[model samples]
Target chain A: MRTLKFLLRKEFRQIFRDKSILAMIFIMPTVQLIIMPLAANYEVKNIQLAVVDRDHSSYSQQLIAKIGASGYFRIVADPRSFRDALRLVEGNRADLVMEIPAGFERNLVREGAQNLALSVDAINGTKAGLGAAYLTRIIGDFNTDVRLEWVEPGRFNPMATIEVTSLNWFNPRAEYRFFMVPAILVLLLTLVGGFLSALNIVREKEIGTIEQINVSPIRKWQFILGKMIPFWVLGLIVFTIGLTIARVVYGIIPAGSLLTLYVFAAVYLVALLGFGLLISTFSDTQIQAMFVAFFFIMIFILMSGLFTSIDSMPVWARTIAYLTPVTHFIEVMRMIVLKGSGLADVSRQLLYEGLFAVVLNGWAILNYRKTT
Target chain B: MPLWAKTGKTMGAVTVTNLTKTYEKGSVTALDDVSFRVEAGELFGLIGPDGAGKSTLFRILTTLLTADRGTAGVDGFDVVKDYRKIRNTVGYMPGRFSLYQDLTVEENLNFFATLFGTTIRENYHLVKDIYEQIEPFKDRRAGKLSGGMKQKLALCCALIHKPTVLFLDEPTTGVDVVSRREFWTMLNRLKEQGITILVSTPYMDEAVLCERIALIQTGRILSIDTPDAIVRGYPDRLFAARTDDLPRALADLRANPSVRSTYAFGEYLHLAFRQNDTENVSGLSRYLAEKGHSGIEIKPVTPTIEDRFIDLMTRETTPS
Candidate 1:
């Protein structure tokens, strides 16, 4: 225990010596949490739409009114030609176009069928797809209303439609910021936890100080744990600052117990520190360590689904995502903050992260050498 | 009682036998079948060049590394089996400045002391003599200290544990001459306290200070003995010769059949004559004069440890 204390104190002293590191640990996460979520909403609104109304009929005007009333699209241009409608879309003035054929009212009355063409710029695929779907649903509702009015008065309607009332169980209204702030916290913890420990040990090796420790009475485990504990604490401190900012500034609080978050965070920190140690053991220079760490952190953060939904990913990618500690932690964090999930709800994720912590730390300790 | 104290021994000795270490799967032999022992309370020096495996041997004895095939003990404890005991009983100052550089000098000293399961106050006497030098700068970061002060801090840290044996690997290689002298003085004082010291250096001049020395080259021990004995054992009579035109004179002398070995030693060239060459001094001087050499002087000189080292190395490689 004394050995462990000594080691932990040494680590703490080294970390506190660098003031820039302190700022990075405490300040960077708050900025990311505040900025990223505000910019990342999935709901598409105020879409610029162009219309080619060749029919010039009452039915076409009514259909346009229905789309405008939905508040999802705005009729920015009324182009007389198809060419102008395409030009509006190509010039970036409009995102979607609607065209009503010349005989649209006559066809519906004489042949009981009519064609309405909708075109969308699919470059921003998600926004474009949502716009198209909203337009189609609005047009469908308008057509049903016209059919209902034309039917005999006071007749009973027999057709039924299934309605899905999406509750958005955890995050009602799907506030992107609430979902994103906790994930950013996890990312910040990983950045400080993994990169700092790796750079610290590799710096010692580069400066020839590792030789001094190897020859000391200190054991290998003592030295490694001593190096890891300070960074682990730093990780926690960053996580706490992030949580505080989320609560005070954004009115976001964990739905689950804060204690559960901390317990799992501790486990994830071990995994991160072990990963850093493993990198340090293989790298002989600080620059190499930084690059290697950057590579792994990039892969881990991207695959962890901090910015995207893992369920939307392909089957193979989802399988690979399960291997990342960050992925599991992000899920647990979101579950706690949004779902107010208890221990049972997050047990599977916690178990995986805990297992990662043990296996990685064991490997790191085993591979570490007391001598060069 | 502590295991070392329970033994009731006053000093520590190290024994290494058939010690071999191969790196990169037997392609590089850092140490090959090396064997030696340092007596209790004696100062033993291992002298070698950069890759001669002096550091490797020191590490093995310090229990930082295990030899591929050998049985070694420090202070009666097996290096492999009783590594923790050996670590507790030995003080090692590595070849580089390795203390926490961000910490103050005093903090580094205190930290290392605490690591050895003791305090600076308990072992203050062992390190007091050296720690006093850096005590004024106790609050200064170790990185901010000068090379000399850093060396003092390292010594203080190493001695704070009050170990029975002290191992220093090339401790004075980059230190200034004054600090080097001061470091040796500290080692001498520690030796007085009846501590066995094993120091390694590439500098041949330091060989004289050790009670016994091992001259190693290419991972092999060329000879191990007292400096004086090693010098005395030099078989050939050596002569230092210089002329008005020294370089041309050296060239002319090398061309002469009577000279066996020639190397530049500072301003003069140390030359060894063939054993069978019966030519008198005048004959060699006349030969130089005839070759347009002037103001030539030749005198017999005693061999230094470096001289003995060169001679031994030359003889070992030359076919009989």
Candidate 2:
């Protein structure tokens, strides 16, 4: 125990002595937290539209006006010919083109139905998909207006309809920042905890100080813990800074208990830092340790369900997602931050993090040999 | 207890029995059937050039590495089975400066002191003479220290715990002359405290400082003896000569039938004979003059450890 105390003191002095570490601890969280949420947003808007109106009828003009008034699409081209409108789409200046056939009002009044052609650029899938959906809904509303005018206008339309009145359960306003803030918080902790600790021991190995340490009577566990505890505390500090940025900048407050969040975070840091230690033990240089950590963290982030739904991944990927600790932390973070979950609600995730902590640390300590 | 408890080899502060190690799947033999022993409280030296397996031997005995097919012990503890016990009782200063460069001198010393589970005040007397030279700049970071001061600080850290045996690998390889002298003086003081010291160096000049030195080359011990004894064991009478053209004189001497071995040592060319015949001495001056040499001066000279080592190595590599 006395050896461990000395080790901690030495570790902390080294950590603070490095100016880069302090900058990373404070600056990284604030910058990534504020920027990632705004940049990674999924809300698609301001889609460019090109129109080809052969009829030039009042109904065609009215439909175009309604689409523009919706503020979702911008009319970038109003070509007289359909070929010119397609040219605009091909040139990438237009995202979608809407075409109205000749005699469209007459056909609609005489035949009680008309055909309208819509073409969307499928290159950017999300932007194209959302743009097409909005346009279709607006045209349907226009069709309803034409029918209601022929029947008894403004008198309930003589047709039965059901109103949706959708209620987004967790995020009532469906704010993207609320959903992203918690996920980003978990990611920051993983980076600072994983990369810093991974590089720490490997630095000693490169500089030959590890041989000095190894030749002494210091126990293996004492050395490993000495490398761990300081980084673990720094990880928590990074987490707190991320949370503060979330609350102050994004106006996001965790709906769950702070105590539960901290408990899970503390355990997760142990697991993550142990994993970093495991990599350092296998590597002889800082570059090798970094590449190994980077490769895993990339996989962890992409499969953590932070940006995509885990339910949508293939069976093999989903299994990996469940195996990684990041997925569980992200899930529990969302559950607590948005759903007001308690300890009982997140008990299973806490157990998984605890299990990871033991297995990873156990392997690190076992792999660390005083004699080789 | 029997001195050789397990291996039954010669027992001392450190012992190795036919130790062998190979790297890259037995392709490069670092230490091959090599063995040596250092008596208790004796200042021993393993003198060789770089790549002569000096550092490898240090590591194996310190328990930082293991050998393929031999047994080694330090302070009666087996390096392999009782590694932890051995680690507690020995101090090692690797060839490289291994202390924390980011830390101040005092902090680095205190940290190592704490690692051995002892306070500085406990082992102050052991490291005082060496530590005092570096203590004036204790607040300075280790990375910023001069080469000599850096070495002194490394020595203090290694000795902070007061181990029974100390291993230093080339402690004066890169130091200035004045500091190198001071370092040897400090080691002399350390030996007086009854701590067995085993030091390795590439410089043959440093061998004379050791009570006994094992002259090693290519993972083999060429000879092991006291400096004076090894010098006295030279097989042939040696002579030194200085000519206006030294390299030409060396070539001429090497080609002569009477000159057994010749090489340039400093400003003079040293020669050894195939037989203990002083009659050739006067004949050699006339022979060199006939080979277009001028201002030639020749005289009989005593051989240093270096001369004996070079002759031994040349004989070892050449077929007898």
Candidate 3:
């Protein structure tokens, strides 16, 4: 224990001695946390729409007004013909074009039906799909309004209208930042724990200091723990700073106990740092270690169910997702912070993280050879 | 209890028999059928040029490497079996300076001390003679220290644990002459403290400082004896000659039927004669003068370790 303590002290001294690394450790994560949520936002807004009105009628005008007032669409073009409206989309002035056929209002009043041709720019498939869906919803509401106005409201009811009032329980506003901030917090912690410890021993190898340790009587476990524990503690500190940013800037407070969150974070960091040490043992250079850590962290972040739901993934990918520590930690973070889950709610995730900590740390200790 | 348990006796500090190591699928042999021993409290040197397997031998004795075909031990513990015990009992300074460059000198020293399960105060006396020289700049990072200072810091760190056996692989390869002399002086002091020291150097001048030296080349031990004894073992008469033109003198001497071999050695040329040759000084002077050489002088010089080393290497590579 005493040996480990001194080793930890040396590691901390080295880490704190470099001014640039100190800045990178604390400042870079804060900036990334603040900017990534804003840039990676999924809520699509201000869709550009072009309208071609051939029927100079009030009904057609009213439909255009309604689309504009829905707050989702912007009327960027008012073309006199369908050809011009199509040109608007081709020129990138608008994302969608709506063409009302000739006498469209007269036909709708006389026959109670009219055809409206709509074309959307599908170059950016996601924006086009979502904009089209929103337009369809607005048109459906207009259609029902026209029907209710033409007939007596009490007798014209389409067989017992059912109202669907959707309520998002955890995030009522469906704010993307709430979900993203927590996941980014997990990524920040993983980056610190994984890359720093991965490069620790390899740096020793590069500088030739590893021979001094290898010749000593220090146990392999003691040496590994000594090399890793300082980074583990730094990871936790970074985690706390991330949480503070989440609470102070994003107003995200955990529903469960902070103690439970810290407990899981502590165990998760041990597993992460252990995995880093394992990479260090295998790599002889810092560049090799960095590349290997990057490969694993990339996979962990992508398949971690952070941005996409793990259940929606294929069975093979889902199985692989379960093996990544990021997946479980992100799940726990969202559950406790957004759902206000308790110990019982996160017991399964906690168990998995605990097991990972034991297995990975054990593997690192066993793989670390004092002799070649 | 054994002497190692009570007095930290390093009797038979290192022993290797038929030790062989091959790399790249048994194609390049590093150590081939090598055997040697060092008595307790003796300063031993493994002398060889680069790629002579000196570092390999040190690594094996330090338990950092394994031998493929032979057995070795350090301080009565088998290198392969009782590696942990050997690690605790030996201090190794590799060919490269292995101290943490980013760490402060004091921090590096303290770290090694703590790793050996002791503190700076506990082993201060052991490394004090060396560490005190660099103590004023103890707060400076090792990377910023001068070459000589770095050498001292590495030596101090290696000696911090007070092990029974000390292994230094080329401790003074790149060091200046004054620092190299100071380093050997320090080693002589450590030897008086009853620690068996095994040091390897490519510099032949350093070999004379070791009580028993093993001259090695091409993964083979050419000769293992005291420096004086190895010098005495050179059978052929050695001669040093100077001429107005060195290269011409060397070339013409090599062409002579009486001269066995000749090499240009800085200010003069050294010549070796075959044991059965009857060439004398006057005959050699006459030959060099006839070859358009002037200011010729020839004399018998005492053979140094380097001369013996060159002699042994030539004999080994002479396709016998």
Candidate 4:
């Protein structure tokens, strides 16, 4: 215990003395939190539309007005023919074009069916795919409106349809920031904690100070723990910085208890630091350790369900996502922060993180050798 | 002189028997069939060139490395099995400066003290003589200190634990001459306190400072004895020769069938003959003059440890 105390003291003194470490601890978290969420905005808005109404009927006008009123689209041009609307799309002024064929109201009344043509610019694939889907759904709703207005009780029998009124529970209107903020917090903590611990040990090795430590009477566990605790404390400081940015800059508040969030974060840091130290034990230089840490952290971030939902992935991909500790923490972070879940609600994920902490730390400590 | 006792008596502070180590699957032999011993309170030197495996032997004894094929012990503790005890009882300063560069001098000292489960306050007396010289620069980071101060700080850090044996590998390799002399003086002082010190160096002059030394080359121990004994074992009478043109004189001397060996030592060439006597020694002056060398001089000189070292090295290198 006395040995650990001195080691921690020495480690902390060096950490605070280093200019690069200080900059990484304070500046990196703030800049990443502010810039990443604003730039990573994925919600597509203000889609451009061109209209070609050949029939000039009130039905076509009403349809155009409804598309604009849905708040997803902006009608940029109204042309008399399909060729003119195609010009608008080709000129890049419109994202997609919608054309109503001639005699659309007469055909709809006589045959009860009509064809609506849609031409979308496919260069931006996501924008084009979503725009086409959105236009199709709006036209379907318009058709239902027309049938309700013109149907007579005795003239035609109408079949009942089911409707779903979706009540968004955690995030009303599903703001993207609430979902991204919690995960970003996890990413920043993992980066600061893992990198400092790994590079710190490898720096000692490269400078030949590790030989002195190896010959000393310090126990393996004491030395490893001494390395771990200082970086763990710095990681928490970075985490707090990210949270303040989320709360003040992004206005994201945790719906669950802060105590539970900290509990999960504390365990997650242990698992992550263990992983970093393991890489250091294998590597002899700081550059090698940094590269190894980057490979694993990149996998962790991608597989953590931070950018994409895990439920939509294939069986193999989902298995990989479940295996990483970050995935479990991200799930628990989203549950606790956005869903206002209590500790009891996320007990399964908590248990998994705890298991990861034990296994990774135990493996690293055993692999660290003082005699070789 | 051995102090005879500080706390307890032991057979040998360190003992190694037929130790062997190689790198890259026996392709590069670092230490081949080496063995030696250091009595308690004795200052022993491992003198050789840079790659003579002195550092490897020190590492093995310090428990930082394991020898592949022999038994070694430090302070009566086995280096392989009782390594923990050896680590606790021995102090090692590697050839390179290994103190934390970013840490202050005092902090590095305190850190190593606590690492061995002791405090600077408890063991301050052991390192007092060495540490006092460096105490004024306690606030300075170790990297910013001069080369000499760095070695002093390194020595203090190694001594803070107050172990039974101290291992210093090439501690004077890069130090200035005055600092090197001062360092050896400090070692003698530490020896007076009954600490067994094992020091290695490439400088032959430092060999006489230790009570005994083992001259090594190419991972082999050529000779191990007191410096006086090793010098007395010189086989043939040696002569120092110099002329206006020294290189030509060396070549001319080598051309003689009776000349056994000749090599430059500073401004003069030291020559050892197969059949050495006063008549041949005086006749060498006329021989150099006949070879067209001017201002020729020849005289018999007492052999130093280095003279014997070179003689042994040449004898082993040239095939019988």
What's the lDDT of the predicted structure labeled candidate 1? 0.86
- Runs of candidate 1 with Cα error greater than 4 angstroms are A40-165, A369-372, B1-12, B242-256, B276-298
Clashing pairs in 4: none
On the 0 to 100 scale, the lDDT of residue B244 in model 4 is 95
**B75-100: candidate 3 lDDT, tens digit per residue:** 88889999999988898989898888
DockQ: which candidate is best? 2
TM-score of each predicted structure versus truth: 0.85, 0.92, 0.88, 0.84
lDDT of 2 by residue, B1-320 (tens): 23444546444899887889888999998897887778989999999999999999999999999999888888877899999998899999999998899999999999999999998999999999998889999999999999999999999999999999999999998999999989999999999999999999999888999999999988888888999999988888788999999988988998899888899899998888777776888888899899999999998899999999999999998956
Full-model lDDT for every candidate: 0.86, 0.91, 0.88, 0.89
Report each candidate's C-alpha RMSD, comma-separated, in the order given.
Answer: 5.1, 3.1, 4.2, 5.1
Against the native complex, each candidate's DockQ, computed on alpha carbons, is 0.44, 0.76, 0.72, 0.67
Ranking by DockQ: 2, 3, 4, 1
Q: Order of candidates by lDDT, top first?
A: 2, 4, 3, 1
Per-residue accuracy of model 3 over A40-72 as CA lDDT, tens digit each:
877667889999888879888899999999998
Model 2 residue A276 lDDT?
94
Instruction: Assess the local accuracy of residue A15 in candidate 1 as a C-alpha lDDT between 0 and 100.
Output: 76
Clashes of each: 1, 0, 0, 0
Cα deviation at A255, candidate 2, in Å, is 1.5
Q: Write the per-residue lDDT of candidate 4 for residues B230-317, one digit (tens) a residue.
A: 9999998988989999889989999987789999998999988888566787677878888899988888899998899999899889
TM-score of chain B of each: 0.92, 0.96, 0.94, 0.95
